[model samples]
Target: MITHRLVRTWEVLPSGGYSTAWAELTGRRLAARGRAVGLLPEPHWVTYTLDTGDDYVTSRLRVSVDTAGGTRTVDLRNDAGRWTVDGAYRPDLDGALDCDLGLCPLTNTMPVLRHDLHRGTGGGGSGPHDFLMAWVSVPDLAVSANRQTYTPLAPDGQGVGGPRASRVRYSSGEFQSDIEFDERGLVLDYPELATALTR
Candidate 1:
């Protein structure tokens, strides 16, 4: 039984692609389905479904990609901090709390919500928080473990003349960007990556 629902759309900056997602909240769990079309690296489209626990930690994910080579799919599950892909245990992703789907901004919401980073509290006092992520590659469905960090930035006053809109600095190795998020902790703008569309 779903108690709440939300929908969001984003425009992929570099490749001129677009994605739309619909999410449902039932009890303390959340489930979402999304589709994305892009031409980066190659021309392709992707569809995915995600389920998360009460804490916004990813529990299961399934992704399907379609390209000139046809379509391939991958299923991943996280149970008690342990991870499995395509029914095979992956110790490398054991402790990962979330899945960073390549080129998908929705994946960032979990960490932000969990740590209250959007409210400018969690990461502010404790500094940046680090996490191991189950990173999924686009159009390939390949999974790997990656390390990333999120640090809260001061409010930029883009919403309601208050801190309704927030920023978080996302870093993975040499790549870093200051991502702006809306009041509900959804990505509003990700420099050089994507931007939320008013739909």
Candidate 2:
């Protein structure tokens, strides 16, 4: 299979930190590695690797964190909707299709690609679909189930000569933001969270 490489960098708006990622795509399956450093709830750095099936659902995730206190790591795997965290079965994460790494924009690409949202269209029909995510808290690696929604939005008529971009309204509880994505389903802007840094 021919492999395609993608590289992206994001600036953490709130923490003045940054994240960079390198991904390889092979026949719809994706494998990625990323690093993040931030000063939010505390000073910390993180490194992660993610693997997903052809359907764009997360299959394996490994995250490592370094803090002033110490270093810790977590490994999560999803096998046909069943999940295991750190080699232990996590019933609470059952049925989750994706993992949301805190402060990482790269994680959002899966769902957007799955739903064809990057093309400014719903997965199949018009919808604000709900998704179950294994939310990983940074600096702690605590895993939990999070219910999030993704709503496809019409383009704002801004991309005339640049790369094709799409918009989506991402909502979790009361927090909501209109995120912009590139043609490849990678995040371009994530409102108050992060923004892609062009090279």
Candidate 3:
């Protein structure tokens, strides 16, 4: 069976070109164990949530970094199980995942999910950096409230863990330390460490 979702996503790229993704993923009952598609692909955990009646999945992603000293990667997955993290909005962000912002579907997009985020990373000029994100099942994107320049407005959706996350722009001069996380305040992807590898 397939489950539907009103997931929330946040993608960020540092001034140095390192990308970070923060996605508040939520949906109906999902598979207990599956692969969460991301910058480097990682293992996922599926569980149930009392508030949204959805699966509160938490994934531990694998991140490899090449620093000037050497290369290292930390196994950042705690216990793979269900957790309870539902409320208004997690200011601390239950968990966060770091990845290559360029790898996010919002930048190029693929069959993983069909979307209409033509905003293109926002770098148009005199504006903020644009954000285009959509899950595979939800075609009607949650825009308007965020004033996104896209199609198929879906204003009646929640951001899974809490209130929907706002779409950020690079031009805004705002930079976040991490991206891509679960409601449990976990970090899914780590790009800062990865950038050190490329350099």
Candidate 4:
């Protein structure tokens, strides 16, 4: 497969902060590096890899956050469906599905686009669409498995086959957020948070 490289600029919503990143995606692998500054309460940089075929089979994600408290770092990996933080395996996360990094919205796009999840038909029977994924938060720099759901939004008249945007709601214990993504599955807008400047 051909390698596709993308560069995106992001704006921290409400605050109008900014960040940028470059990503490369091949057939069954993805590698990306980004610098996030002023986009959050603190600035940070992240590098990650998603080794997947039809699903998120494994991954390695690392981040370094710079804050008033001090500089904090986290390294996490998913091996053979098991999760590890820093270098120690966490039995608690053994069954988690995918990983969510703290610093970039780009990483979130992987599972969304890769899965091509069906657009629910309607009404009470959209079926069980919730997905369990390993989530990492920059605010706390902790990793956990979280449930997330995606619903197709009203048609926006874009993309090849149909509307492109989808609503994403995720909850990890006490943390949650409603996010939006484009047809390509890259984050479109993050509400009071961040918006992608590049398509």
TM-score of each: 0.92, 0.94, 0.24, 0.74
Which pairs of residues collide in model 2? Answer: none
After superposition, candidate 4 runs with Cα above 4 Å error: 14-16, 39-58, 118-128, 154-179
Instruction: Give lDDT tens digits, candidate 4, residues 1-199.
Output: 7987878878866333665767766774667677766535544443344444344344777777676677777888877777789999888777766677655677677655555532322331333346667778865677877677654433344432236555555444565665676555567777656777777
Model 1, 75-161: lDDT tens digits are 999998889999899999988999999889888888887887877754445489999999998978889999999999866566422
The full ranking of all candidates by lDDT, starting with the best, is 2, 1, 4, 3
lDDT of 4 at 33: 73
Winner of 2 and 4 under TM-score: 2
Error of 1 at 188 (Å): 0.5
lDDT of 2 by residue, 1-199 (tens): 8987999999987767999999987877789999989987789899999999978889999999999999999999998888999889999988788999988999998888887887786453457979999999887999999999999887678752255777889999999999998888888889999988853
Candidate 3 lDDT, tens digit per residue, 28-86?
32212111222322221111111112222223323343334354332222232321122
Candidates 3 and 4, the one with greater TM-score: 4
- What would the C-alpha RMSD of candidate 4 be, to one decimal place? 4.3
Quick one: best lDDT, which candidate? 2
lDDT (CA) for every model shown? 0.85, 0.87, 0.24, 0.62
In model 2, what lDDT does residue 97 have? Answer: 88
> What TM-score does candidate 2 reach?
0.94
The per-residue C-alpha lDDT of model 4 at residue 182 equals 57
Clashes of each: 0, 0, 24, 1
Which candidate, 1 or 3, would have the higher lDDT against the true structure? 1
